[model samples]
Target chain A: MGIVNVKKDNFEDVVLKSKEKVLVDFNADWCGPCRMLRPILDEIASERSNVKIVSINIDDEEDLAMKYGVSSIPCLVLFDGGKEVNRSVGLIPKDAVIEFIGE
Target chain B: MYDIIIVGAGPSGLTAAIYGRRANKKVLVLEALSYGGQIINTLKIENYPAAPNISGFDFATTLYNQVKDLGTDIKFEKVIEIKDGIEKEVITTKGSYKSKTIILATGCENRKLGIDREEELIGRGVSYCATCDGGFYKDKDVAVVGGGNTALEDALYLCDVANKVYLIHRRDEFRGEEGLVDKLKEKNNIEFVYNSNVTKLNGDDKLSSVIVTDKEGNDKEIMISGLFIAVGKIPENENFRKLINLDDSGYIIAPENCHTNVEGIFVCGDARVKEVRQLVTAASDGAISATEAIRYINERK
Candidate 1:
């Protein structure tokens, strides 16, 4: 499956209630580095079956971003069993994502 | 195991991929961020031999395309650790790859403006890369801190985008090229803040101003939306420090050649100990390290 674009409406079902591990990417449309990171995250989403990749636009879901304490764009927060296991800030490579998810 | 695993996709790493692929080795390049590295932020590179005054983006694209044509596999990943042995295990954030030889070209990160709330307000209003975040401050005031070519270039680039640009430096004299300094001086919106340093970043949730202190210990707060820290960079060798010998400043100690303390692991570019760090020198190191790595692999075979 491809990466999922998340919003406030269905975030509870798709992320909090999901069975598999979730990788939530917090980003904005105007962020240049965030744009660069999109394709890389998509590539990872395509390759990984154990983990689910999703993106939450901070502009659209400001409350979700504030709850997560994401001070930077392109922030990746890994959640397992409905809890945050790890998080990374800034635009890091794919290996970092794998490492962040404890894979 | 593959023949070679090159870390980083900067000028040095990309150059290595070109050389390694030509030698008929299965080369894999793992990059932490974008393929272009720091040069992608550079506006114009005037001295990159035979390609005078070429844009950094164009130069990196050409090199990346050349490496792709040669069949060198490029992976975007952040390498977390390296297990050295007969067959090296290069562990990244995403996955692990084994290779006979490893090229450690993982480059440097922008030196932070270590001050209050600076780290906390990274994307809010404080940024290190002008090219990446300059658009956000369009028609707004921004301050760039540093005395190097990158600082001067950032100021020049921001002059076109931001309504006002403050070039903040600790010393009165700039270490950047005379041409760039002159160009920055010509920009109508650019203001020079000589012999001063940014003491603190002021604002909550978002940066609204910065406290700049001069030589006389006088503090002046400048109201600006963005603060671009262009103050050079530090080697990003924290992850591989356990397996490699590094200098006091955290640069990989490759003294003369690219060969590290490990037999099969070699380092090149700004990540390694060196007197000068430039685009041309980084490419040169890439060629040298790839050649040395190739020889090592050949002798083993």
Candidate 2:
């Protein structure tokens, strides 16, 4: 599956309640690095069937951003069993992202 | 082995790829992060010739595509080390490759504000690129630290979104353009804190305030939701230090011809020690370095 856009209303069901490990990308529309990271995440989403990918637009979901302590764009947080196990900030290559997710 | 292995996907490296491909030589471009490098953060690139008012992202994307269409192999990998010899070996985090020639255009990264808890506070309240994180501080107070064009631009960009912006610089006079400084002076929401430095970052989970100390040693605490650091950039040439000679500032010590101390290894872009580090000059270095690399390979044969 492709990257799922997670909003406040569906964030819990789409991200927190998912059975597989989810990689939540905290991003914004105006951010250049965030836009650059989209294609890499899309590739990951397609290749890794066991994992899930979701994106949160901080502009629309300000409360969710605050709740997650996200103060940067392109912040990737890996969630396993509905808990954030690992997180990486800023733009990184695909191999580094895969290494960050421990896949 | 590839004819040319360019280490960096910025304007200089991408431009080198274009030149190398046009010469009908196998070229591989390795980049650790996203393409475009620091230029991607720039909102408007007015200085680049013929591309007036074009966004930096657009220029970089076009160049990237142009190189891609030419069949230049671009890999996203972090270069850890390089072995210099007749056949140079370029090692990356993922894998390694051998090339007849290598172009080191790694470029520069944001210089950090060396205060306590600065690294820990990243993404919490501190950011290097205002264009990337300024949106998070909408209607909230923020501070910018630097005295260059980037600092002034960040202040101007943040002034429109944040409730208030405090521009703190170590020197009283800004090193940025007079026009940009003048533009910043006109903003009512932007306040200038001259001859000062950020001494401390104050917050637990996130940043709430910063301690700014002036030349007189007087400390002033500025309450803000975010701090954008535009102090300038430092070269990422540590990995290549053993293979190449670097100046005190860690920039590759190369001549105007872009040839390094080691043969078959050329340096270009912001990574090289030069006075003017603009887009045009970088592209110019790319062409010169690629041409030199092509000549070197032909002479070897």
Best-performing candidate as measured by lDDT:
2
Q: Mind giving the per-residue lDDT tens digits that candidate 1 earns over B1-301?
A: 7899999999999998888999999999998778878786555788888998777767877888999999998887778999988999999877899999999998888888778787778878888877766766769999999998888988998999999999899999999899999888788998899899899887866889998999999999999988899888898888887889999889999965799999988888999999889898999999989999999999999
What docking grade applies to model 1?
A: incorrect
Model 1, residue pairs in steric clash = A94-B77, A95-B77, A95-B93, A95-B94, A96-B93, A99-B93
List the candidates' TM-scores in order. Answer: 0.73, 0.94
Writing each residue's lDDT as its tens digit, candidate 2 over B156-202 gives 99999999999999999999999999998899999999999999999
Alpha carbon lDDT at B199, candidate 2: 96
Candidate RMSDs in Å, in order, are 5.9, 1.9
**For model 2, how does the per-residue alpha-carbon lDDT over A26-103 read when each residue is reduced to its tens digit?**
987667788788889999899899899999988899999989989898899999888999888888878778898885
